[model samples]
Target: MLSYALLVHAAPYSEQGALSALRFAQAAVAQGHRVSSVFFYRDGVHNASTLMAPPQDEVHLAEGWRALAQEHGTELLVCIAASLRRGLMNAEEGVRHGREAHNLEPPFVLTGLGQLVDAMQANDRVITFAP
Candidate 1:
Protein backbone atom coordinates (compact mmCIF):
# COMPACT_ATOMS: atom_id res chain seq x y z
CA MET A 1 0.00 0.00 0.00
CA LEU A 2 1.23 3.48 -0.81
CA SER A 3 1.82 5.98 1.98
CA TYR A 4 0.52 9.51 1.62
CA ALA A 5 1.36 12.92 2.99
CA LEU A 6 -1.49 15.43 2.69
CA LEU A 7 -1.09 19.19 2.50
CA VAL A 8 -3.95 21.55 3.28
CA HIS A 9 -3.58 25.21 2.29
CA ALA A 10 -6.87 26.89 3.12
CA ALA A 11 -9.02 27.65 6.12
CA PRO A 12 -11.24 24.73 7.19
CA TYR A 13 -14.53 26.48 6.51
CA SER A 14 -13.40 29.12 4.08
CA GLU A 15 -12.84 26.61 1.32
CA GLN A 16 -13.39 23.03 0.34
CA GLY A 17 -9.73 22.05 0.42
CA ALA A 18 -9.67 21.13 4.08
CA LEU A 19 -12.69 18.87 3.91
CA SER A 20 -11.45 17.43 0.67
CA ALA A 21 -8.26 16.41 2.39
CA LEU A 22 -10.22 14.78 5.17
CA ARG A 23 -12.47 12.80 2.84
CA PHE A 24 -9.50 11.80 0.72
CA ALA A 25 -7.70 10.58 3.81
CA GLN A 26 -10.70 8.53 4.88
CA ALA A 27 -10.89 6.99 1.46
CA ALA A 28 -7.17 6.33 1.40
CA VAL A 29 -7.17 4.62 4.77
CA ALA A 30 -10.22 2.55 3.84
CA GLN A 31 -8.36 1.40 0.78
CA GLY A 32 -5.56 0.14 3.02
CA HIS A 33 -3.20 3.03 2.39
CA ARG A 34 -1.32 4.97 5.02
CA VAL A 35 -1.57 8.68 5.71
CA SER A 36 1.72 9.57 7.33
CA SER A 37 0.85 13.19 8.07
CA VAL A 38 -1.65 15.92 7.33
CA PHE A 39 0.28 19.17 7.05
CA PHE A 40 -1.81 22.30 7.61
CA TYR A 41 -0.06 25.27 6.12
CA ARG A 42 -1.00 28.93 5.56
CA ASP A 43 -4.63 29.49 6.49
CA GLY A 44 -5.04 25.79 6.91
CA VAL A 45 -3.46 26.10 10.35
CA HIS A 46 -6.86 27.35 11.54
CA ASN A 47 -8.00 23.75 11.40
CA ALA A 48 -5.96 23.04 14.56
CA SER A 49 -7.52 25.78 16.70
CA THR A 50 -9.17 24.06 19.63
CA LEU A 51 -11.12 27.24 20.21
CA MET A 52 -13.24 26.87 17.13
CA ALA A 53 -16.85 26.53 18.23
CA PRO A 54 -18.87 26.15 15.13
CA PRO A 55 -22.65 25.96 15.03
CA GLN A 56 -24.01 22.68 16.34
CA ASP A 57 -25.45 22.00 12.95
CA GLU A 58 -22.11 22.13 11.23
CA VAL A 59 -19.53 19.39 11.18
CA HIS A 60 -16.60 20.09 13.45
CA LEU A 61 -13.67 19.86 11.08
CA ALA A 62 -11.02 19.87 13.80
CA GLU A 63 -12.70 17.07 15.67
CA GLY A 64 -12.94 15.02 12.52
CA TRP A 65 -9.20 15.30 12.03
CA ARG A 66 -8.58 14.55 15.67
CA ALA A 67 -10.70 11.42 15.51
CA LEU A 68 -8.87 10.31 12.40
CA ALA A 69 -5.54 10.72 14.19
CA GLN A 70 -6.77 8.86 17.24
CA GLU A 71 -7.96 5.89 15.23
CA HIS A 72 -5.17 5.64 12.69
CA GLY A 73 -2.13 7.24 14.31
CA THR A 74 -1.96 9.80 11.57
CA GLU A 75 0.06 12.85 12.53
CA LEU A 76 -1.75 16.21 12.41
CA LEU A 77 1.04 18.69 11.82
CA VAL A 78 0.46 22.43 11.66
CA CYS A 79 3.06 24.92 10.50
CA ILE A 80 4.16 26.92 13.52
CA ALA A 81 4.90 30.06 11.58
CA ALA A 82 1.59 30.01 9.86
CA SER A 83 -0.30 29.20 13.02
CA LEU A 84 1.38 31.93 15.08
CA ARG A 85 0.78 34.49 12.37
CA ARG A 86 -2.91 33.73 12.54
CA GLY A 87 -3.06 33.83 16.36
CA LEU A 88 -3.28 30.07 16.74
CA MET A 89 -0.71 28.55 19.11
CA ASN A 90 0.15 25.69 21.45
CA ALA A 91 0.71 25.83 25.22
CA GLU A 92 4.45 26.39 25.02
CA GLU A 93 4.05 28.99 22.35
CA GLY A 94 1.39 30.83 24.32
CA VAL A 95 3.73 31.05 27.30
CA ARG A 96 6.61 32.10 25.13
CA HIS A 97 4.50 34.82 23.61
CA GLY A 98 3.18 35.97 27.01
CA ARG A 99 -0.37 34.87 26.36
CA GLU A 100 -2.77 33.29 28.82
CA ALA A 101 -4.09 30.56 26.53
CA HIS A 102 -3.50 28.45 23.46
CA ASN A 103 -5.57 26.61 20.91
CA LEU A 104 -3.14 24.09 19.44
CA GLU A 105 -3.57 20.89 21.34
CA PRO A 106 -2.49 17.25 21.43
CA PRO A 107 -2.96 15.34 18.15
CA PHE A 108 -2.44 18.73 16.54
CA VAL A 109 1.25 19.61 16.68
CA LEU A 110 2.68 23.03 15.91
CA THR A 111 5.93 22.38 14.12
CA GLY A 112 8.40 24.01 11.80
CA LEU A 113 8.49 23.59 8.04
CA GLY A 114 11.22 20.98 8.34
CA GLN A 115 8.59 18.53 9.57
CA LEU A 116 6.71 19.05 6.33
CA VAL A 117 9.89 18.29 4.46
CA ASP A 118 10.36 15.23 6.62
CA ALA A 119 6.82 14.09 5.91
CA MET A 120 7.39 14.58 2.22
CA GLN A 121 10.55 12.51 2.48
CA ALA A 122 8.94 9.78 4.53
CA ASN A 123 5.84 9.24 2.44
CA ASP A 124 5.50 7.68 -0.99
CA ARG A 125 2.98 10.24 -2.27
CA VAL A 126 1.94 13.79 -1.48
CA ILE A 127 -1.57 15.08 -2.17
CA THR A 128 -2.17 18.78 -1.74
CA PHE A 129 -5.55 20.50 -1.35
CA ALA A 130 -4.93 24.13 -2.04
CA PRO A 131 -7.00 27.29 -2.02
Candidate 2:
Protein backbone atom coordinates (compact mmCIF):
# COMPACT_ATOMS: atom_id res chain seq x y z
CA MET A 1 0.00 0.00 0.00
CA LEU A 2 1.16 3.55 -0.68
CA SER A 3 1.94 5.69 2.35
CA TYR A 4 1.05 9.37 2.66
CA ALA A 5 1.90 12.29 4.92
CA LEU A 6 -0.27 15.41 4.78
CA LEU A 7 0.60 18.98 5.72
CA VAL A 8 -2.37 21.27 6.40
CA HIS A 9 -1.65 25.02 6.38
CA ALA A 10 -5.08 26.60 6.57
CA ALA A 11 -7.73 27.13 9.17
CA PRO A 12 -10.56 24.63 9.08
CA TYR A 13 -13.37 27.12 8.52
CA SER A 14 -11.39 29.79 6.72
CA GLU A 15 -10.54 27.60 3.74
CA GLN A 16 -10.96 24.15 2.28
CA GLY A 17 -7.40 23.03 2.76
CA ALA A 18 -8.00 21.04 5.93
CA LEU A 19 -11.24 19.58 4.63
CA SER A 20 -9.60 18.68 1.34
CA ALA A 21 -6.80 16.94 3.18
CA LEU A 22 -9.35 14.92 5.13
CA ARG A 23 -11.15 13.87 1.98
CA PHE A 24 -7.88 12.94 0.34
CA ALA A 25 -6.94 10.87 3.35
CA GLN A 26 -10.29 9.11 3.44
CA ALA A 27 -10.02 8.34 -0.26
CA ALA A 28 -6.47 7.08 0.17
CA VAL A 29 -7.59 4.68 2.90
CA ALA A 30 -10.63 3.59 0.95
CA GLN A 31 -8.25 2.79 -1.91
CA GLY A 32 -6.10 0.73 0.46
CA HIS A 33 -3.38 3.34 0.93
CA ARG A 34 -1.98 4.36 4.32
CA VAL A 35 -2.00 7.84 5.84
CA SER A 36 1.01 7.94 8.09
CA SER A 37 0.52 11.34 9.67
CA VAL A 38 -1.15 14.75 9.37
CA PHE A 39 0.99 17.73 10.39
CA PHE A 40 -0.88 20.97 11.15
CA TYR A 41 1.15 24.09 10.54
CA ARG A 42 0.66 27.88 10.51
CA ASP A 43 -3.00 28.77 10.67
CA GLY A 44 -3.85 25.12 10.24
CA VAL A 45 -3.19 24.62 13.92
CA HIS A 46 -6.61 26.12 14.49
CA ASN A 47 -8.00 22.73 13.55
CA ALA A 48 -6.76 21.48 16.92
CA SER A 49 -8.74 24.03 18.90
CA THR A 50 -11.22 22.31 21.19
CA LEU A 51 -13.36 25.40 21.70
CA MET A 52 -14.75 25.36 18.17
CA ALA A 53 -18.50 25.06 18.08
CA PRO A 54 -20.12 25.21 14.71
CA PRO A 55 -23.87 25.54 14.31
CA GLN A 56 -25.94 22.40 13.73
CA ASP A 57 -26.49 23.34 10.11
CA GLU A 58 -22.79 23.35 9.36
CA VAL A 59 -20.40 20.44 9.35
CA HIS A 60 -18.01 20.06 12.26
CA LEU A 61 -14.72 19.76 10.38
CA ALA A 62 -12.74 18.81 13.48
CA GLU A 63 -14.95 15.80 14.09
CA GLY A 64 -14.30 14.66 10.55
CA TRP A 65 -10.57 14.94 11.18
CA ARG A 66 -10.85 12.98 14.43
CA ALA A 67 -12.92 10.33 12.71
CA LEU A 68 -10.36 9.92 9.96
CA ALA A 69 -7.54 9.67 12.46
CA GLN A 70 -9.34 7.08 14.58
CA GLU A 71 -10.64 4.94 11.74
CA HIS A 72 -7.39 4.97 9.80
CA GLY A 73 -4.89 4.80 12.69
CA THR A 74 -3.36 8.00 11.37
CA GLU A 75 -1.41 10.29 13.67
CA LEU A 76 -2.63 13.87 14.13
CA LEU A 77 0.35 16.05 14.94
CA VAL A 78 0.21 19.81 15.36
CA CYS A 79 3.18 22.15 15.45
CA ILE A 80 3.86 23.21 19.06
CA ALA A 81 4.92 26.73 18.19
CA ALA A 82 2.03 27.29 15.87
CA SER A 83 -0.47 25.78 18.26
CA LEU A 84 0.82 27.87 21.15
CA ARG A 85 0.66 31.06 19.15
CA ARG A 86 -2.91 30.17 18.24
CA GLY A 87 -3.80 29.27 21.89
CA LEU A 88 -4.24 25.59 21.23
CA MET A 89 -2.44 23.93 24.08
CA ASN A 90 -2.51 20.54 25.73
CA ALA A 91 -2.76 20.15 29.53
CA GLU A 92 0.96 20.15 30.18
CA GLU A 93 1.59 23.10 27.94
CA GLY A 94 -1.25 25.06 29.50
CA VAL A 95 0.10 24.50 32.98
CA ARG A 96 3.61 25.35 31.92
CA HIS A 97 2.43 28.55 30.38
CA GLY A 98 0.28 29.36 33.43
CA ARG A 99 -2.87 29.36 31.41
CA GLU A 100 -6.22 28.51 32.93
CA ALA A 101 -7.32 26.20 30.13
CA HIS A 102 -5.96 23.92 27.48
CA ASN A 103 -7.88 23.60 24.28
CA LEU A 104 -6.01 20.81 22.51
CA GLU A 105 -6.88 17.37 23.77
CA PRO A 106 -6.49 13.70 22.90
CA PRO A 107 -6.19 12.44 19.32
CA PHE A 108 -4.11 15.56 18.71
CA VAL A 109 -0.52 15.72 19.88
CA LEU A 110 1.75 18.76 20.08
CA THR A 111 4.99 18.31 18.22
CA GLY A 112 7.81 20.12 16.52
CA LEU A 113 8.42 20.57 12.80
CA GLY A 114 10.99 17.83 13.06
CA GLN A 115 8.02 15.49 13.05
CA LEU A 116 7.10 16.92 9.66
CA VAL A 117 10.54 16.11 8.38
CA ASP A 118 10.23 12.64 9.87
CA ALA A 119 6.90 12.19 8.18
CA MET A 120 8.43 13.26 4.89
CA GLN A 121 11.22 10.76 5.33
CA ALA A 122 8.93 7.92 6.36
CA ASN A 123 6.07 8.28 3.93
CA ASP A 124 6.10 7.43 0.26
CA ARG A 125 4.38 10.72 -0.54
CA VAL A 126 3.82 14.06 1.20
CA ILE A 127 0.92 16.31 0.28
CA THR A 128 0.55 19.91 1.41
CA PHE A 129 -2.88 21.54 1.58
CA ALA A 130 -2.55 25.31 1.38
CA PRO A 131 -5.09 28.09 1.58
Candidate 3:
Protein backbone atom coordinates (compact mmCIF):
# COMPACT_ATOMS: atom_id res chain seq x y z
CA MET A 1 0.00 0.00 0.00
CA LEU A 2 1.26 3.44 -0.91
CA SER A 3 1.38 6.11 1.76
CA TYR A 4 -0.08 9.38 0.49
CA ALA A 5 -0.30 12.94 1.78
CA LEU A 6 -2.97 15.28 0.45
CA LEU A 7 -2.34 19.01 0.62
CA VAL A 8 -5.39 21.23 0.28
CA HIS A 9 -5.00 24.96 -0.36
CA ALA A 10 -8.49 26.12 -1.27
CA ALA A 11 -11.50 27.16 0.67
CA PRO A 12 -14.24 24.63 1.36
CA TYR A 13 -16.94 25.77 -1.08
CA SER A 14 -15.27 28.14 -3.50
CA GLU A 15 -13.43 25.36 -5.33
CA GLN A 16 -13.15 21.60 -5.78
CA GLY A 17 -9.86 21.16 -4.00
CA ALA A 18 -11.36 19.91 -0.74
CA LEU A 19 -13.78 17.55 -2.46
CA SER A 20 -11.11 16.24 -4.77
CA ALA A 21 -8.80 15.61 -1.85
CA LEU A 22 -11.58 13.78 -0.02
CA ARG A 23 -12.42 11.61 -3.03
CA PHE A 24 -8.77 10.87 -3.64
CA ALA A 25 -8.26 9.82 -0.04
CA GLN A 26 -11.36 7.66 -0.12
CA ALA A 27 -10.31 5.98 -3.34
CA ALA A 28 -6.84 5.38 -1.95
CA VAL A 29 -8.28 3.61 1.08
CA ALA A 30 -10.65 1.56 -1.08
CA GLN A 31 -7.73 0.50 -3.23
CA GLY A 32 -5.79 -0.67 -0.15
CA HIS A 33 -3.44 2.33 -0.05
CA ARG A 34 -2.83 4.23 3.17
CA VAL A 35 -3.57 7.94 3.50
CA SER A 36 -0.84 9.17 5.82
CA SER A 37 -2.32 12.62 6.42
CA VAL A 38 -4.28 15.59 5.07
CA PHE A 39 -2.50 18.91 5.47
CA PHE A 40 -4.72 22.01 5.29
CA TYR A 41 -3.05 25.28 4.40
CA ARG A 42 -3.98 28.75 3.11
CA ASP A 43 -7.74 28.98 2.80
CA GLY A 44 -8.03 25.23 3.29
CA VAL A 45 -8.04 25.87 7.01
CA HIS A 46 -11.78 26.51 6.74
CA ASN A 47 -12.33 22.78 6.24
CA ALA A 48 -11.70 22.16 9.92
CA SER A 49 -14.19 24.72 11.25
CA THR A 50 -17.19 23.25 13.07
CA LEU A 51 -18.94 26.61 12.81
CA MET A 52 -19.45 26.24 9.07
CA ALA A 53 -23.10 26.25 8.02
CA PRO A 54 -23.28 25.95 4.31
CA PRO A 55 -26.64 26.45 2.58
CA GLN A 56 -29.00 23.48 2.63
CA ASP A 57 -28.65 22.96 -1.09
CA GLU A 58 -24.88 23.32 -0.88
CA VAL A 59 -22.49 20.56 0.09
CA HIS A 60 -21.01 20.79 3.59
CA LEU A 61 -17.44 20.14 2.67
CA ALA A 62 -16.17 20.62 6.19
CA GLU A 63 -18.38 17.85 7.52
CA GLY A 64 -17.48 15.65 4.60
CA TRP A 65 -13.78 16.03 5.39
CA ARG A 66 -14.45 15.35 9.05
CA ALA A 67 -16.36 12.18 8.20
CA LEU A 68 -13.62 10.98 5.91
CA ALA A 69 -10.98 11.44 8.58
CA GLN A 70 -13.15 9.81 11.22
CA GLU A 71 -14.05 6.82 9.05
CA HIS A 72 -10.58 6.17 7.71
CA GLY A 73 -8.61 7.25 10.78
CA THR A 74 -6.68 9.75 8.72
CA GLU A 75 -4.84 12.55 10.45
CA LEU A 76 -6.22 15.98 9.46
CA LEU A 77 -3.76 18.74 10.27
CA VAL A 78 -4.63 22.39 9.71
CA CYS A 79 -1.90 25.02 9.57
CA ILE A 80 -1.88 26.86 12.87
CA ALA A 81 -1.03 30.22 11.32
CA ALA A 82 -3.64 29.91 8.65
CA SER A 83 -6.37 28.75 11.02
CA LEU A 84 -5.59 31.48 13.52
CA ARG A 85 -5.71 34.19 10.91
CA ARG A 86 -9.05 32.86 9.74
CA GLY A 87 -10.42 32.60 13.28
CA LEU A 88 -10.74 28.82 13.06
CA MET A 89 -9.09 28.10 16.34
CA ASN A 90 -8.79 24.93 18.39
CA ALA A 91 -9.50 24.84 22.14
CA GLU A 92 -6.02 25.88 23.19
CA GLU A 93 -5.68 28.56 20.58
CA GLY A 94 -9.05 29.98 21.46
CA VAL A 95 -7.93 30.39 25.04
CA ARG A 96 -4.68 31.95 23.98
CA HIS A 97 -6.48 34.39 21.73
CA GLY A 98 -8.98 35.23 24.49
CA ARG A 99 -11.90 33.74 22.63
CA GLU A 100 -14.96 32.12 24.12
CA ALA A 101 -14.57 28.74 22.45
CA HIS A 102 -13.06 26.88 19.54
CA ASN A 103 -14.77 25.33 16.53
CA LEU A 104 -12.28 22.68 15.43
CA GLU A 105 -13.33 19.05 15.74
CA PRO A 106 -11.61 15.78 16.59
CA PRO A 107 -9.16 14.11 14.19
CA PHE A 108 -8.55 17.63 12.87
CA VAL A 109 -5.52 19.03 14.66
CA LEU A 110 -4.23 22.59 14.68
CA THR A 111 -0.57 22.03 13.97
CA GLY A 112 2.63 23.58 12.74
CA LEU A 113 4.06 23.49 9.22
CA GLY A 114 6.42 20.82 10.47
CA GLN A 115 3.56 18.34 10.22
CA LEU A 116 3.44 18.81 6.47
CA VAL A 117 7.21 18.45 6.24
CA ASP A 118 6.95 15.24 8.24
CA ALA A 119 4.21 13.97 5.93
CA MET A 120 6.36 14.68 2.93
CA GLN A 121 9.23 12.79 4.50
CA ALA A 122 7.12 9.74 5.32
CA ASN A 123 4.72 9.53 2.39
CA ASP A 124 5.74 8.15 -0.95
CA ARG A 125 3.47 10.62 -2.71
CA VAL A 126 2.68 14.14 -1.59
CA ILE A 127 0.00 15.52 -3.83
CA THR A 128 -1.22 19.11 -3.61
CA PHE A 129 -4.74 20.18 -4.59
CA ALA A 130 -4.86 23.94 -4.81
CA PRO A 131 -7.49 26.36 -5.98
Could you say which candidate leads in lDDT? Answer: 1
Ranking of all candidate structures by their TM-score, best first? 1, 2, 3
Local lDDT at 117 for model 3: 94
Per-residue lDDT tens digits of candidate 3, residues 23-52? 788899999998879999999998888888
Looking at model 1, the pairs that clash are none
lDDT of 3: 0.88
Question: Which pairs in model 2 have colliding backbones?
Answer: none
Ten-residue stretch with the least lDDT total in model 3: 62-71
After superposition of all CA atoms, the RMSD between model 2 and the true structure is: 0.8
| Tens digits of per-residue lDDT for model 1, 1-131 | 99999999979889988889999999999999999899999999999989889899988999999988999899999999998999999999999999999989999998999999999899999999987
What order do candidates take by lDDT, descending?
1, 2, 3
Better candidate number, 2 or 3, judged by lDDT: 2
Which residue runs does candidate 2 get wrong by more than 4 Å? none
Candidate 2 accuracy as TM-score: 0.96
RMSD each, Å: 0.7, 0.8, 1.2
**CA lDDT, candidate 2, residue 60:** 85
Off by over 4 Å in 1: none
Q: TM-score of each candidate?
A: 0.97, 0.96, 0.93
**Residues 1-131 of candidate 2: C-alpha lDDT, one tens digit per residue:** 99999999989888988788888988999999999899999999998888889898987877878887888889999999998887789999999999998999879999999999999999999999989
